[model samples]
Target chain A: GAGVSQTPSNKVTEKGKYVELRCDPISGHTALYWYRQSLGQGPEFLIYFQGTGAADDSGLPNDRFFAVRPEGSVSTLKIQRTERGDSAVYLCASSDIAGAREQYFGPGTRLTVT
Target chain B: AQSVAQPEDQVNVAEGNPLTVKCTYSVSGNPYLFWYVQYPNRGLQFLLKYITGDNLVKGSYGFEAEFNKSQTSFHLKKPSALVSDSALYFCAVRDMLDTGNQFYFGTGTSLTVIP
Candidate 1:
């Protein structure tokens, strides 16, 4: 089966610009999550969606970051007025509702705010 | 708040020798500890998890981890190291009782299995 997949494996944009990262979760996965990874660091949770609605957005750094998982399958992470500090790898993961909490990760989209 | 820590930034071991990567976690409730390995430029791969039952849990690639409740630790161990095992490892913790389903990951530890 196809694992979680992210689009635009790499993206480079200027500071103050806007960027959107996409994620396609595995078939039958009801839960999806977004995380950010800086150099030499582990992934930090960003947002999570259960079904068609976001169950938790507390991990989002600020109002500039927002995510949506419409139809409970594909998700998009949107950054507004991106800053150089927003440069990092954006990871997407998905898991089945009935299954354990082990998440399947995607290749991730590397966002570089120049 | 829940968190995990990989105190060691890097660890080196000769092939055929034992290897251990330390991990400790802090959570308000019983933790669901997990270990993941990531190769260069690849996404993190799940190795093992300690949900309940036995404290000793076996995982993929001849790996295992010991869950110590008192010490608040769940260290990854392998009896014999392999050069291929060299990679970055991350320790994660999740609270079973947290309805929000938030998970935390450590900084990560780089393991170099010398041949």
Candidate 2:
């Protein structure tokens, strides 16, 4: 059984550029979540999806931060007008429908805005 | 609104000695408590969770946490520390009563095990 995985383990982009991070959840997982982790800090919730629709996206910082799980398996996080403050690790997690609390995390994608 | 707190910025312990990382949480409902460990250059790994039942819950890598309802605390403890145990620990809380599955995480407490 493979764990959650993210593409482009690392990404570097200039400030004001747009970047999209992808996450592949575990097979059959009905719930997915995205989090942002700044250096020396804990991961913060960004969005959550149940099935094909986002169940809770209130954690999104602003309009520039958006995410979608269209097929209900893979998710993409889009950040427009990237800022230096957005330079951090983006983590994706997935859990079974019965146990949403026991989430399995991906290795994370480190995004650096220069 | 729910929140978690890891009052200690860091905790130091010698190899073979006991260690404890304190965590407290505030919520409006029966809380779902969780502990996660993160190694450098990696993502979070779930250690243990306290949904209900036992007050003391054991987790991977010889770690355990005690959930206290009256005191609003869930302190992680280990009988003997190891150098490999050194990492960042985060305490999270979810208000199970809420319709949204939102989790609140603490700032994290770094553990340093001296060999």
Candidate 3:
């Protein structure tokens, strides 16, 4: 079976620009999560979605970061007025309803704010 | 707050030699411990997890982790290292008792398997 997939392996943009990163989770996964990983650091949680609604989003750094999983299978992480500090590899993960704790990750989309 | 710690920044082991990656966590209640490996330009791959019951949990690629309640540790171990095993290793913890049920990851340890 295909694992989770993220679009746009790499994206470079100027500061203060808006960017959207998409993620396609594994088929039938009801839970989705977003994380950001800076160089030399581990991934930091961003947002979490259970079904169509976001169950936990406290990890989002600020208002400029937002995520949506409207249909429950696909999710998008949007950043507004990106800053150089926001440059990092964005990761997406999905897990089955039965075992929500064990998640499967996707190849991240590296976003560089130039 | 709940957190995980990987004291070692890097661990180098010779091929065919035993290897161990240390992990310790602090959480409020019964925790869910997990180990994940990441290759360059790739996503994290799940290695093993310790939920309940057994203290020793085996996982993919001949890797295993031991859950120690006294030490609050879940160190990943393998009998023999392979050159291909070189990668970044992460230890994560989920405090199920917490309302948020969010996962906390360690700083990560870079493993180098020298041939």
Candidate 4:
């Protein structure tokens, strides 16, 4: 089976610009999550969606970060007015369900805000 | 808040020797612990998980983890080290009782297997 896939493996943009990262979860995965990983650091949670609705958005750093999982399969992480601090690897993961299932991760989209 | 900690930033072991990467977790309720390995420029790959029942859980590539409730730790261990096993390892924990059920990851430990 195909694992989670993320588009635009690398994206470079200027500060204050907008960028969108896409994720395609594994087949039949009902839960999707987004995380940010800085250099020499672990991945930090961003947002999670159960089905079409976002079950948790608390991990989102600020209002500038938003994510949507419409149609219950594909998800998009949108960053508004990106900052240099936003430069990092954006990871996407998915699980069969929300509980104790292990998440399958994608190659991730590396966003560089110069 | 749920959180996990990898006390060691790096671990080095000779090939064919045993290896251990330590991880501790804090959660309000019973924990769902997991181990993941990441190669350079690649996404995280699941190693193993401990939901309940057995304290020792085996995973891919001859990896295993022991879940300790009293110590609040889930340490990743392997019987023998291989040069191919060198990678960054992350420990994660999820509070089963939490409604959101988001995982908390550790800082990550880089493992280097010296040949």
Candidate 5:
């Protein structure tokens, strides 16, 4: 089975620009999550979606960060007015219907805000 | 707030020698622990998880983790080390009450297996 897939493996943008990162979960995965990993650090939670609705978004750093899963299978993480501090690898993961199930991860998108 | 800790920044073991990577967690409720490995320029790969039941859980690549409730620890171990095992290891924990379904990850530990 195909694991989660993210598009635009690498993206470079100027500060204050906008960028969107896409994620395609497995065929039947109903839960999707987004995380950010900085250099020399572990991944930090960003947002999560259960089905079409975002079940929990408290992990989102600020209002500038937003994510959506309109069709329940594909998700997009959007950043508005990106800052240099936001440079990192954006990871996407998906799991089965059960919340506690193991999550499959994608290669991730490396976003660089110069 | 839930958090995970990896006391060692790096661990080095000779090939064929036993290896251990320590991890501890702090959570408000029961903990769902997980171990993941990441190679350079790659996404995190799931190694194992300890949900419940048996304290000793076995996982992929001849890896295992022991869940110690009394010590609030879930340490990753392997009977023997291989050079290919060198990578970044992460320990994560999810609190039962965390409605967001977010897992808190440790700082990460780099493992190097010398051949």
Candidate 6:
């Protein structure tokens, strides 16, 4: 079985540019999550989706961050007007259900904003 | 205000020696605890979880964690540390009250096992 996977393993972009990170969750997973990890730090929650609806978006740092899961299998995290502070590894995870505490993570999309 | 804490920034041990990584958590209600490991240039891998039942929970890669309710701690331990076990370990906690389903992670603890 294929675990969660992300596209564009590494992305280098300039500040004020827009970028999108994609995630393909495991088959049959109804819950998807996005997190950001900075150097020497643990992952921080960004957004969570149960089914096709976002169950929680409180973790999103600001209005510039947004995510969507249209068909409920694949998800995309979009960041508008990227900043140097956004330079981090963007991680995606999925679980069987929203209540399931265990999550399978993807290799992540490392975004370097210069 | 759900949060997790890993007191040590790093832990060093020799191969074949016993290892311990401490984690503490705070939540409003019964908590669900989890442990994860991250290798360099890799995503986080789930190690184990404590949702209910027995206090001692075993997980992947010959790892186990002991959940202590009184101490509000879930410490990861291994009988014999291997050089390959060196990586960053994270402790996470989820509040039972919140239906949003999000895990709050610790600062992470780097493990270094010398062979």
TM-score of each: 0.98, 0.97, 0.98, 0.98, 0.98, 0.98
Error of 5 at B113 (Å): 0.1
Better of 2 and 5 by TM-score: 5
Chain A, model 6: TM = 0.98
Model 1 lDDT per residue over A4-104, tens place: 99999999999999999999999999999999999999999998899989998999999999998877789999999999999999999998972247998
Tell me the tens digit of each residue's lDDT in model 3 across B1-115: 7999999999999999999999999998888999999999999999999999999999999999999999999999999999999999999998878766588899999999999
lDDT for every model? 0.93, 0.92, 0.93, 0.95, 0.93, 0.95
Error of 3 at B59 (Å): 0.4
* Candidate 3 vs candidate 4, DockQ winner: 4
Off by over 4 Å in 1: A98-100
Q: Pairs clashing in candidate 5?
A: none
Clashing pairs in 2: none
Task: Point out the worst 10-residue segment of candidate 6 chain B by lDDT.
Answer: B94-103
Quote the positional error of residue B60 for candidate 6 in Å: 1.3
What fraction of native interface contacts does model 2 preserve?
Answer: 0.65
Native contacts conserved, per model:
0.67, 0.65, 0.60, 0.79, 0.67, 0.77
DockQ comparisons of all candidates to the true complex? 0.68, 0.67, 0.66, 0.87, 0.74, 0.82
Scored against the native two-chain complex, candidate 6 gets a DockQ of: 0.82
Instruction: Output DockQ, candidate 4.
Output: 0.87
* Candidate 2, superposed: residue stretches over 4 Å from native: A98-100
lDDT per residue (tens digit) for residues A1-114 in model 5: 788899999999999999999999999899898999999888898888999999989889999999999999999999999999999999998988644677888999999999
Candidate 2 per-residue lDDT, tens place, B41-81, comes to 77789999999999999999999999999999999999999
Among all windows of 10 consecutive residues in model 6 chain A, the one with the lowest summed lDDT is A94-103
Q: Is the docking of candidate 5 incorrect, acceptable, medium or high quality?
A: medium
As for DockQ, the candidate ahead, 1 or 5, is 5
How does residue B65 of candidate 6 score in lDDT?
Answer: 96
